[model samples]
Target: MKAAVLREVRTPLQIEDVQINKPGPHEVLIRTAAAGVCHSDLHFIEGSYPHPLPAVLGHESAGVVEQVGSEVRTVKPGDHVITCLSAFCGHCEFCLTGHMSLCVSPETKRGQDDEPRLTSKKGPMMQYLNLSSFAEQMLIHEHACVAIRKDMPLDRAALIGCGVMTGVGAAMHTSNVRPGDTVAVIGCGGVGLAAINGAAIAGAGRIIAIDMAPGKENMVKAFGATDFICAATSADVVKEVIEMTKGGVQHSFEAIGLSKTAEQAFNMLRRGGTANIIGMIPVGQTITLMGAAFLGEKRIQGSLMGSNRFPVDMPRLVDFYMSGKLHLDDMISRRIKLEDVNDAFTEMKTGAVARSVIVFDA
Candidate 1:
């Protein structure tokens, strides 16, 4: 199968033919239909985050099951599915306690001694996440994906895998935004827009979308943000948000994942409000907050995959999309095939598009 292989940091992914293994007892094999070139993938590609080299890099996707291992019962051949990076071990303390997204047990992947799931003539290739959807196929643990209705468009459904789930989950589960609450999202990319849309669905009275991009008013407004704030790097963003909400928003989300903006998200929160950090900050970087700030009961927390339980939440997200309550069509800025994955990352760096999905044939 053809896949985009990331062999080094600060380099373009080479589109090459790769090899895939059949399903393990708990694995499911999928024929990739559509995969979203997500910002998360870009993080790894650009060295913002590190991963093993010579890996197939993609996680947000939806496809049809072609085969299932003997022990895989969650889905069957011919089922439409959305893949998630948060592959759970199902019986870990996290999963047992309703925190499946936090699971990171090695049990989810084959042991190093065992045969690799993917390889090239050079050697064994690491799978970027449990699901490497950038390729024409994905061999993943059954828990890493969930079945959605066949009526849902696979292209749109692909967004739900990571960006949609992360944004919405951050709003509904991580911070638990309440009706009538005022909220501000720090970035207006795919994840940020999803947070705004999720805030709307959660009934937030005021949703503020922040971005520096021109021509973003319509995009943010379409996703249910009542107001748009054009961010200036040098401007006092916290002051702007505080003044707009008359004090501060009830909740502020740092979706951009930078130390500067993470601090701003906390500063823009009202007393007792929570700031959820949804972006993947680079390792070794730390965020600092004033010591006096905590006296006001202002809190900051990190959210993993929007604190998702995909099997339950994902299908409901599909229903939300199907019902027209969730705005997804506008999130897709372009649909390109796998060969054009590199250009999509370039567009992402410019922050000019919401999402670019790899429709196997797109």
Candidate 2:
């Protein structure tokens, strides 16, 4: 199958004919339908996150099941499914305790002695995360994906797999923003806009969208933000947010994953408010916080995959989109083919586009 192979760090993904293995007992083979280019994938490309090289890179995707292993029962052949990186081993402590995203069991992946799930002329090709949806076909654990309603567009559904899940889950689950709470989300990208939308869906009294670009105000407001603040124009974002809310918001979310913005998110919170960090900060970068600030009961926490239970949340997200509550239509800035993956990553660096989807030919 034709797939994008990242052979080295800080380089373009090469499109090549790679080999995918047959399904394992708990695996499922999916025919890639649509995959969304996300910032998280860029982290690996830029070397912010380290992964084994010569891997197929992509995670946010939706596809049709081509075949299932003998023991796979969650989905059948021909099912429409959204794949998630947070593959869980159902019997682990985290899974049993309702924190499936935190599961780290080795059972979900093949052992060292086993044959690799993918390979190329050079050698074994590592699977990025668990999905590796940038390829024409993905062989992943059955638990990594869930079947959604067939009518849902796979392109839009692809966003729900990662960006949407992270943003919405951060608002609805992690911080638990209430009906009358105020929320300020840093960064107006795909994840940031989804955070704003999620806050609205959670009935936030006021939602503020912050970004460095003034042009994004209209787009951000359209996604349920009651107000927009251009961070580039502001001398102090934290002060501006505090003044706008008369003291500070009940909740603030950092979606950009910068140390400065993460600190600002904490500083923009009201007393007893919670700050959720949704971005993947680079390895070894320390996020410093004020020592005295803890006296007021202000708390900062991290959210992984929006603290998601993909099996339950993904389907509901699709329903939200179908019912016109989720604004995925505006989220897609462009639709490209697999060969255009490199350009998509370039555009992501500009921070101008919300999302780009790769639609595979049937």
Question: Positional deviation of 247 in candidate 2, in angstroms?
Answer: 0.9
Off-target runs (Cα >4 Å) in candidate 2 are none
Tens digits of lDDT, candidate 1, 239-287: 9889989989988888887998999899999999899999888888998
- What's the lDDT for all of these models? 0.92, 0.94
Error of 1 at 5 (Å): 0.2
Residue 350 of model 2: what lDDT?
Answer: 90
RMSD of 2: 0.7
Superposed Cα deviation of residue 344, candidate 2 (Å): 0.8
Per-residue error for 56 in candidate 1, Å, reads 0.5
Clashing pairs in 1: none
lDDT for residue 196 in candidate 2, whole number 0-100 = 95
| Winner by TM-score | 2
* C-alpha-based local distance difference test score of model 1: 0.92
